[model samples]
Target: MYRPKTTLEQWRILQAVVDHGGYAHAAEKLNKSQSSLNHAVAKLQSQLGVQLLEVRGRKAYLTEAGEVMLRRSRHLTQNVQDLESLAANIQQHWEPEITLAVDLAFPRSLLYPSLQQFLPECRGSRLKIIDTVITGTEEAITQGWADLVISHHVPKGHLGEVIAQVNFLLVCHPEHPLSQTSGPIDPNELSQHLQLVIADTSQSPDEKQGWLKSEARWTVSQFHTAVDLLLQGIGFCWLPEHVVQPHLADGLLKQLDLDGSSFRRLVSYLVKPRPDNIGPGSQLLYDLILSNRQVIRQDDNTATTGNNP
Candidate 1:
C-alpha cells in the first residue's frame, strides 16, 4: 500500500534527521519540537506504506528501506534548489544563450580562465562554441551564426583589437627528406615537395590561402588533420609553435632552418555589433575575455603561448 504524497518538506526533515543522527537532535537543529518531527516521519512512512524508522537504545535510526528513500530524497532536494536558482537567474534578465566563434589556430587554453570567471556571474546563460579556420571565423559573424569571434582574420571594415601574437614555425617529420637537406631550404626548394595546408573553411572553393602549388598539396579543414598527415612524413608546412612543441620535444618533428625572421601572426577579438541590444550575460563574457588577455600579458610569455590545455 505504498502511496507516498511526499513533499519537499518531508525530504528536508528526513535529511535533517540523518544529519543530526537522531529525531530529537534533528528537531533541535530544525527548531521544531521532537514530537512534531516524529509525527512527520511517521506520517511520511504511513503515506508511503514503508517503515522508515526504528528506535533502539533511546536513539532513532532509519530502517533499510528508509536509507534507500533518503538517498533519493537528497537528489530530489538538490534538483529543487537548482530549479529555484535558475528561476532567480532568469528573473535577472540574463541572456538565454550566446554563440562564440574561435579560430582553429587560437589557443583554447587561454579561453578557460575567461569562461571560469564568467560562470558565477552568468550562471543562467548557455554557451555554444564554434571553431573556425581563417576566413571561417569572419563568416561565422557575417552569416549571423556567432555572437563573438576570436581570430587572426576579421572581415574588412569590422573593428578588431589585437589580443595575442602566435608564432608559426615551418616544420616536418624528422624522417622527411627536407630534414636531410644541407643548406637553408628556400621557397623554390619547398615548392618541389608536397605542402600540407589547412583548407579554407569557406564553402566557396575559390577562396583559398597558403596553397603553395597545385601539383603537390594536401588540403584539410582542420589543423590537427594537417599535423597528423605531416607527422606521417607525407608533407611539410608551417604550424603554430604552441601546437607542435610536444612533437618537437619527442623528436617526432623538427623545424626547417629557413633564412628569414621568425614568422608570427597577430590575433584579435571581435564582438558582434548590436547597437540597439546586448544582453547582460553576453556583455559580462566579452568583458571577461578582455580581462583574461590583460591577465595573461602580465603573467608570462609561456602561459599565453601554448596548445589547448
Candidate 2:
C-alpha cells in the first residue's frame, strides 16, 4: 500500500496557527513551543509540496491553496470527531437509531413539540418515524420494527400508557348532501353515500374501521388523500379534529349532526415494544411525550370550560 507522508495532527497544528494568527499565539493557546508548531507546519508543506501559509508583520495568513486545503481539512476533522462520539455512544449502550411508530390519528401539535425536545438530547443517535394507521401500529410492535409506539392499539402481552385522546369529527364538504340535512341524520341515511376510509398498512389481512357499509367505499392509504377526496365532494368520513380544524374554520368542511354522538374520541397509548431493553434516548422521548400530554390536557380542559379566550 502507498502511504502518504502526512498526519492529522500536522493539519490541526497548521489550522491552529492560522486560527490564532501566529506561531507565538497558537503556541500559547496549545501550550506548545513555537518552534514545534513551526517544524510541524514546515514538514507538512514539504510533504505536500505546497506553500500553505504567508507570514506578514506579526501574523500568519493562509495562501490561496491553503484556504482550499483548510476547508477540506475542517470537514475531515469534524467527521472524525463525530465518529468518536458515535463510538462512545455505542459503548454506553445508546441506540444508534430509535424507531417510533405513530398512528395517523395522533395529534401533530403534541408529536412535533416532543420530537423538538428530543433532538438536542439524542447525542449522535438517529430517529426513524413510522406513520401507521390502525393495525399497522400494532404490527410495528409485534414485528420488532419499532422502539416506541404511539397508537390506539397496544398489542397483546405489551404494556402501554394512555398519552393523548384524539377527537375525530365526522365531516364532509360544505356542499355535500349530508351537510344539507337540517336535523340529526340516521345511520341508515349515512350508508346511502360514499364513505372514505384509510386502509390498513400492515402486511397481514386488511382490517377495516369506521366503515358505514356503504355500497360506494374508497380505501386510501393516507389521511391526506382522504381529505383531498372529501374536498372534491366525493365522500364523507371521520377525521381528526386537529387535522381538519383549518378546513372547518375556513368553511370548507362541515360536521354531520348524527342521531347519536357525532364525534369519536380515540385514546392513544405510548407503548414500548422492548421494555426490558429500552435505551436512554427512547426513554427520554417517552418522558417528554408524557409531560407534553399533561400540558395539552390542561389546555383542552381550559378551552372546554370556556376559560380561554
Candidate 3:
C-alpha cells in the first residue's frame, strides 16, 4: 500500500540530517560514525525500495524520493508528538481554552463543525480557545501566547497561503427600513441607517471607512457581538458573507446593497510554519479550517439565491 511510517532510529536519523544537512553532518550530530549513518541509510533505502541519498565528493544529496520521505516522516513524527500533547490539553480546551488569534470575529457555527469533525480524530487534543485583537494577535505570534494564528493577507510579514475568498456582506434586520427601500442605496445613506463594525482585525481601517460612515451606531471588535446587535435591530454591519447567510434567509436579517461602497473580504489562511511547510498539527488545523470554510460557502450560496434558504 506504499504506507509511510516513522521509526525511532528513522526519527533520530531525520533529525540528524536536518540539523547537520548531510549524512556526515548527521553522524556528527548523533555523535555516531559516518559509516554507521551510511549503513542505516542503506537499510532504510532497502525497506522503502528507493534511493534516498547520493554520495558526491564526501557530500550527500537527497533524491526526490528521499526528500518526499523526509517531509512525510517529519510530518508523521510531529503528529505523533501532537497526539501526546493534545491529551494533556483536553480538559483545558474544554475550559474556555484552545488559544486562536483570529480576525476580529469568525463563524461560531462553522467552528463547532470544524472542531467536531477534526478534534475527535486528533485523539481529543484539549483546547484553550482564546481570542486576541488583531494587533494583539500579531504580538501574540511574536510572544508565543498563540500556538496558531488565523488572519488575512496583510502587507506586513505573513506566514501562509491565501486559501479562499472571505466576502464582505452588508446585512441588516429583515424588517429594517433599508430592506423596504428600493435599489442599491448610497454608502452615505446606508451608513446613516445603521452601522456595526469590527475595530481590530487584519483589515486596514481605511478599507472599512467607506462601509462604515463617519457616524456608526455601534462599533464593536467581535463578529458575534456585531451579529447580536444587528439581530437586535441596532444597526447594520459589513460582515463576511458566509457568516450571515442563515440569519438573512431566516428572515432574521437582510443584506444591503452599497452602490458606491467598495467592500470585499478576501479570505486568506495565515499560519506560522504554514500547511505544506508546517507541522502535522498545524497542517491538520489548516485543512480543517479551510474545509469548514468550503462548507460555509456552500451553505451561503444555497441560502442567499435559492427559493428556500
Candidate 4:
C-alpha cells in the first residue's frame, strides 16, 4: 500500500468504502467523521481527475473507475507481498535455475564443453539440460518443458532470433564404390547403394521418404550410430561438422559430391517468453553462445541432421 510520490491515503479510502460498503461505514472504520471521510474521497478524485463513487441519499456505491482502482490496488498489494518473498530468498543468495531442452544433434562434443567453461559467466546459476531431441525446440517452448532450445526449425511462437547457422553434408566410407565415382552423384543412382540414415523423431514424413530413396537402407536412431555404421563401410549418412571433425580427419569418412540437394540445415536459437530482466547467468550464457558462434561450420560433418527441405 506504500506509494512513492503519490499519497497512499487516497487508496486506503477507496479500499475502505469497497470493504465497508458505504461512506458512513468507511468513516467508522477509519475513526473519522463522515464529513472528513467525504472530503478525503473528494480530494482523491480531484487529484486523480477521476470519479470513484456515486452517492444517492443513504447509499454510496463505487463508480466503474473506483472498481477498477480497487482491483489494481489488490494486485499491487499482492506484488509487494511477492517482492518481499523474493527478496528474502535472494538475500540468502539463492541461485535461479533454468531447465533447457536440446536436440540430440546439439553438437554435444562442442556445446557441452563450452557450456561448462562459460557457465561461471552465467553468475552462479544452475542449468539442467533436458534431452528432448525428437520433440524439438518448438514443442519444448510451447509445452513449457524448456527455457531455451536449439534446432533447425524456428519455433512457431515467440521465436528468438536465429542466433547461428550450420549446414549438413553427405558422407560415406571412402573405399565404397560410390565414392570411386569422379563426378557428382545422382540421388536416383543411390537407390542401389547402401544408405545409412539417422532417423531422429524431429523428421517429417517427407524427410523419411527422401531417405527412402535408397533401396538398401540401414536405419540408426542416433547420429553417432549412423556415423559409426558409415565408417565401417556399411553406408553413407550426413553429419554435422562438430560431430564429424575428428572422424573426418582420421579418414573414417569422406564427403560425397551431390549434384542435386546440398542438404543444408539452419541452426536456430529458441527462447520462451521471459521477464524483462533476464538473470545475469542467462544473459552471460546467452552472450557466450553468441561469441563462440564462429564455430558454426558450413561443411557437413560425419553424421548430422538430415536436410529438412
TM-score per model over all chains: 0.80, 0.91, 0.50, 0.55
- Residue-level lDDT of model 4, residues 245-300, one tens digit each, is 67778988888887776665756564643524445455556555554543333465
In model 2, which regions exceed 4 Å deviation?
A: 1-5, 205-208, 295-309
lDDT of each: 0.76, 0.85, 0.62, 0.66
Error of 1 at 285 (Å): 3.0
Best by lDDT: 2
Task: Give per-residue CA lDDT, model 3, range 1-309, as digits (tens).
Answer: 766543558656855765587887788778988888777777777777888778777667788887887777777778877766666555444222345566544445545666777676655444566564545555555555555676554435556544344677888887778777788877666756757666654333334333445474666867878889888887777788777888978989888777865456555454662222344444566567655553124554421211121
TM-score of decoy 2: 0.91
Q: Distance from true position, residue 256, model 3, in Å?
A: 1.1
Candidate 4, TM-score vs. the true structure? 0.55
Better of 2 and 4 by TM-score: 2
Q: Model 3, stretches more than 4 Å misplaced?
A: 1-98, 108-125, 132-136, 142-144, 199-210, 273-309
User: What's model 3's TM-score?
Assistant: 0.50
Cα-lDDT of candidate 4: 0.66
Clashes of 1: 0
Q: What is the lDDT of residue 37 in candidate 1?
A: 85
Tens-place lDDT per residue, model 2, 126-224, is 999889988888888888789999988777899888767778999999999999998998889999999998877787745555645688888898888
Better of 2 and 3 by lDDT: 2
The model with the greatest TM-score is 2
lDDT of 1 by residue, 1-309 (tens): 965488889889978988898888899999999888888888888888998889898787889998999999999999888778778777876667888888878778778999988887776678988787766776875675676788777666566656566778888998998899887877677778998877667675345455365368878877788789888998988798889989999998988886553365555565564523666777788777876672135355554433232
Candidate 1 C-alpha error for residue 225, in Å: 3.0
